[model samples]
Target: MTTRDTTVAVFRPDDERLRDAVELVESLGATPVADPMLEVRETGASPRTDADYTVLTSKTGAEIARETGWEPGETTVCAIGSATAGALREQGYDVDLVPDEFSSTGMVELLAERVDGARVEVARSDHGSQVLLDGLEAAGAYVHETVLYELVRPEGAGGSAELAASGDLDAACFTSSLTVANFLAAAEERGIRADAVAGLADAVVGVIGEPTRETAESEGIAVDVVPENADFDELACAVVERAAPTYHD
Candidate 1:
């Protein structure tokens, strides 16, 4: 196997996950640009009540729910993604279900068989799409949602612009539509024009799935990985395989 050094920019936020990514990059002998283009803010709380089921959509949701002392025993918690599931588990809740696809549709499919007219409460970001709740309600399940947090676009994508301008970035991974949109916005805020951004067309743009890929494609960035599933491992492997010439060529 050929090992080539890659410089990658992570446009999410300066969180524990960012620290983990930094460590991973160092382990691989690759450079990581910590450009925090998205800031997560806890903005709402779910009142303590008897809920039959709880849907944890993101780590932010899990954190906020944990902070607000959401009890796990009374409610069967279903995490939308594995990362969220891990977060919930760390917070002492046994995650009953995790979607294989890691999207609203996938969650809906799994939930359709599990919930037996249970009252479901969704803990999620304020600005996230309502597809999960809508799907659950359409399937004859009692569902309600509480906004746990909001994702604010950062002032600018400082690190991404610097890495891209120096032509050092081999790839950038976007996990969500918000990440892709805010990363580009941050690049523009740091004075990167359309032509300059487009010039990195050869750079591998790794996206989690179709929605994120669509957002990146709309911004004119070349997507090298639109994984069959939206799992984090799949995304990471896809990025490594596609960005390295030895793996793809």
Candidate 2:
């Protein structure tokens, strides 16, 4: 039996997407741990009136807005990527723009062509990166942001912290800055060493976007791979390949 000590810790909510990552890990014969660091909560309402554009960056955003309800009719919906666009479309929102690249900067670039001086409301995580908001505002879009959710880790990560403390994890996947921050907070709560987490600099530390990569680097974690896009599937495949190439089924 080729028992690999590699483990890929996914700090995402226990959504279908988490399951997808778990399946990917199993296909590679590696252990998959569900170590969610953030909880997504859809809050508030359409804070702006007659928003010419609505920007959704994650599936949680789409679901929150859909559940909260919005005025019917065509509102140019811009998404960070295809996956988010699909999520918006499935929820009955007409997706007008889905950038080729996946990031707030990407979405801002995509919106430049269709909006300028137009009121735009962004449904985003409570702790959001300023790139998108700054870029869009610079591009002359009337940007308003609504904190749709917060990402928090589960009560305790079981004994996963001990594994990372001992450098047992071959890799860890951080999909968002919140996930990265929350994961570190959880580790500290469990008395894990900073070096043990940073050791992934030599191993596989997967990030979903530039912002996430930047955060990981700042935390002294070696980021071995960042997908071409921010889609979870793209990230999952990249992490699996980087950490356990031979384990791939």
State which candidate has the highest lDDT: 2
Worst 10 residues of 1 by lDDT: 193-202
Per-residue lDDT of model 1, residues 1-249, tens digit only: 243567666665778877876666545555666777678877757633567878888877877888888776677778887788888888777888788888888888888876657788887887666778888887778887788877888664566765665676777778888887777676677677464366457577788878788877887777877877666556666676666655444
How much does each candidate deviate from the true structure in C-alpha RMSD?
A: 3.0, 2.2
Write down the lDDT that model 2 would get.
0.74
Estimate every model's Cα lDDT from 0 to 1: 0.73, 0.74
lDDT of 2 by residue, 31-56 (tens): 78777666665566543446888888
Residue runs of model 1 more than 4 Å from their true location after superposition? 1-5, 113-117, 245-249
- Summing lDDT over every window of 10 consecutive residues in candidate 2, give the lowest-scoring window: 40-49
Q: After aligning candidate 2 to the native by TM-score, how far in Å is the CA of 101 from where it should be?
A: 1.8
